[model samples]
Target: MKKQITFSIFITMLLLTACQERTTQQIIKLTNPSDFDRVDEPIVLARNIFTIKDIPNKNCIVLDKDQRAIPFQLDDLDEDGQWDEMFLLVDLKKKEQIDIIVMWTDQMSNKQFRQRANVRFANKAGDKILNDVNRLRSTDTKLSQAEFQMEGPAWENDVVAFRNYFDARNGIDIYGKRTKEMILHKVGINGQNYHQLDDWGMDILKVGTSLGAGAIAISSGDTLYRVDLPETSTYHLLVNGPLRSVFDLKHHNFKIGDHQLNINHRISIWGGAACYKSSVTIDGLQGNDALVTGIVNLHSDTYIEEKADQYLILATHDIQAEDQAALGMALLAKSKDVIDVSEAPKEGSGIVSTYLLKLKAENNKPTNFYFYAGWATQDKGYTDKSYFMKRLKKDAMRWSRPIIIK
Candidate 1:
């Protein structure tokens, strides 16, 4: 009787233990699997209270030159119940904690938020969010400039993981400088020093030797070319003047010695004016004089300046044949039939001649409009007389439709 009772009890206990183990496995499988601890993996002590003590006095943190931070949006980041990664945004203008973005590991996680600390920035002028790694690395060496350490996952924290994430997000590896496509902050080399380039020429680069970006420059006899770089990257190098001709003035692919630097540019003009109607006081009507003034209507004025054999080519494009003829006749005091006789392209996509028209004012009265129109070089000359006539004509047609600036 004793043996039977003991055996029965043992069997029941074993069955219950088995049931409990199965239940635990089901819960683990259902709740979340990524949180499972792998063999020999070190457990991360989750960060509970993350705080930024100090922020820079400056109103902005310029990345390269552009400001990246807007008002922080906490809701923008996804979050989970258990502690995960988060972002702390410090608004420099308000001089307070702007937002906390809780990033989550799972799909259905909720985030929490808190207000700014009672301790403000006035007494904490030099105090800033110190970076742990930077402090450790530069323990003996003092920084030349005020170094506010930025704390977060470094770019190379997990090279494989980061590469995956970065490639997923931006779809390119900018640091590597290759892939299907890319975007880079470019600086051109001139001799020993590297200068930042604008559309027209070189400017002081933001990343000099001081920033560890290295000294980049265009050397003597070395023409700055962008072709050696990738297919669709932005070049910070500009084409400086006093030239052996503007080779790739506004072109993408061209050769410059051993290297080929592709060119992309943003072209703009200023201080030019326009006259809408035809009248006397029109300069450079026929004579070889460099400066010419012309009135479109009885009142509107336009000026032209000659550069070498070519008048400064202002704006040139294509327009409709009929409309252009009407405008040419109206502006030039020529017959509409004569205007129609002008050799323009077919009814569609005909070229319209344009010039740089400048208008300035002294006090309140409207000053005269100065303008220019002609070819740049004989090699770069207009293919037809009609192209020049359209611009030269004072009554050149302008569409009444609204031109959208932006």
Candidate 2:
């Protein structure tokens, strides 16, 4: 009887060990073709398949081949206040297949690099200057010079930085980076003092009257116009992340010609990318007007490449900066929506090369596109136009074909 009892105990211990092994083996596979390491971009996995409920409880983990935990975050992509998606910021080698395990753990490891996205609105009470009864401007004038002054909110990630005007002209601007990490803090370091750069990077690009980098406009007949942010244009920071940052710029009633259009814009930026995604929704459109987005052609030395009906790329690499630096700017958009491309030259403001796309309002949904920039002095690769074009094509392909999540 003692021998039989000991045999039963041993069998029970063996079964428990098997169960633990099975739990640790739960994993998902990621397939990539390039040898280049994909940085802070989110690799989204389906939540329902994994049966994940609470991601922040230290219950979920991504394990590597050695069973070590990889840092990741869960995102509420729909903004319903409920976490539904899983994002892992990792580097996958060229032509490598990686297995990511989702298992229960008591301890979660902190991410080493700055894998998150950040945005700051100039909403401080003291930072506002009353331009008019309906308009408020930023007191910080880091970009202010003899004739040009800018006041608005700024955002950045590990790869790139962007800003939009908060006052009369709601134009978008780009901040070029020399470093791969965060550098927006170096801008306006002291109170009311705007420092363009620290030791890491500086604002190398310029935004004058032309779509300034990726500013949106309304195209009617032969003219392109922009709507100013009124008192009712409420600004909200949506997602502040270690992977993605999103914000909403809403205009309750913006006047475009005779119609008062309600516009909502959600801007998102990911890590390890030079471009930020801009999604805009304009209500009260008659479906006849065209939406125009463009890059500034300050020196008239701009090159455009349009691929049949797939994409339109507008690029400029010229000496158009305060330091006479060669800055490369480009706008990429869908070909079906593009109707025409034109050049609008302003006497003192600079030349605005615009891409016109058909504005189709479907149940008041949002329309989206991407705009990005590169500086020659910031990086050696950007000095070659071919390299910039190749990078753009790679990004476009990646955007088209997202990671397949099982």
Candidate 3:
């Protein structure tokens, strides 16, 4: 009886231990490791309820499909208060693109947390990531500015391409040297220069250039872009993908033929197609009142003139509170100077239509100004030309020039 009783106690203890071990296993959780096939799985992260998958042959982990939101803590790596939820491991699969959805709890009172992000996948095949890097480098000129110290296969292309890659990857746009003309070389299949064909683009194309200005052009495919370097530097960015859309930090992109001065960063100049042939003159300071002065000459082969006509100018200085009211009025009243409008003279003779502007002063220091001149007809809007004539008269009005009647 004693032996049987002892054996029964031992058996009960063993069962109890086994039950406790199973309970412990249930409580422990494992983080899902990223792997090849399911690199972009819909991540349902919340407080609880998630499963993991292991691909030993491939050596990866994948999250099982769970639409249910599981709570997870956001690890603020940057410490800026913005939380980073989860990072997905991506690999080339499907079209090398995968869409992922993150069901997160929203901090708002709505009591919901749901979000989604599309993470792209790269091929395990031939230098997939490296090739992407090269594609971006081919268009950016700034990347070439860096003196590459790391040794490797000498990059055959220009440094702009490499710089573009770095900037694009870092969410910045790299600009190349800005010039009025760009020359493109086309090589034939036989490794000979194909300069004979006119459409082949072996010849240089002349694009208009504005003074102290910059511009950006996006390709039709939206896969690549060309950014004119800041006036401060002679560079341009031929950027691939989305990095081509960033704006220049220094110069403003002007769209109108005329503008005004203000502490505001962006100023719009408005006019019509008549502004095209119109000559423009900008008079502004370089450091004090206005950091820049520019004109947006709209040139087009078609007469549609339907595109938005506006000039965007940026100001560098901050204006005082008292000055803000007057400045705002000046901007609205087109108090900023522009060139005068005049008719083109008979073909041969040099009948120059001159426009003049005066520099007014506030504290004995001359205030900045500008002038613009152009030729356009009544059909294109701006028939009266009253504004142009009035501004010209005001600018050239005779001041205190003392003279004796002879």
Best of the candidates, TM-score? 2
Over all chains combined, what TM-score does candidate 1 have?
0.15
Error of 2 at 123 (Å): 5.4
Rank by lDDT, descending?
Answer: 2, 3, 1
lDDT of 3 by residue, 1-406 (tens): 5754654464334335434422111122223232222222222223133222221111111221322213222323233554333322222232233222222111111222222210111222212222212222222434432322111011111111101122222111111111211111112222433223222212111112212111111111112112222122111111111111111112223222233221111111111100101111223323222222222122211111011112111211111112121000001012333222212112222211111111222222322322223222111121234443432333222111111111
- Which candidate would rank higher by lDDT, 1 or 3? 3
Show where candidate 2 strays beyond 4 Å.
Answer: 1-26, 33-41, 46-49, 53-58, 93-96, 104-116, 123-150, 191-198, 220-223, 308-310, 348-363
What do the candidate models score in CA lDDT, each in turn?
0.19, 0.61, 0.21
Task: In model 1, state the lDDT of residue 112.
Answer: 21
User: Distance from true position, residue 183, model 1, in Å?
Assistant: 26
lDDT by residue (1-406, candidate 1, tens digit) is 5754654464334335434422110100011112221111111112333232221111111111121221211211113433232122221221121222221111221112222111111111223321111111222112311231111111110000001000001110001111111111121212211122233112111111110011011111412211122323221211111110000112222233444333322111111111111111211112111111111211112222222111222222222121121111111222211111111112222111112122111222212221222221211233354555544542122111111111
Native-vs-model 3 lDDT?
Answer: 0.21
Question: Which prediction has the highest lDDT against the true structure?
Answer: 2
RMSD of 1: 28.1
Better of 2 and 3 by TM-score: 2
Ranking by TM-score: 2, 3, 1
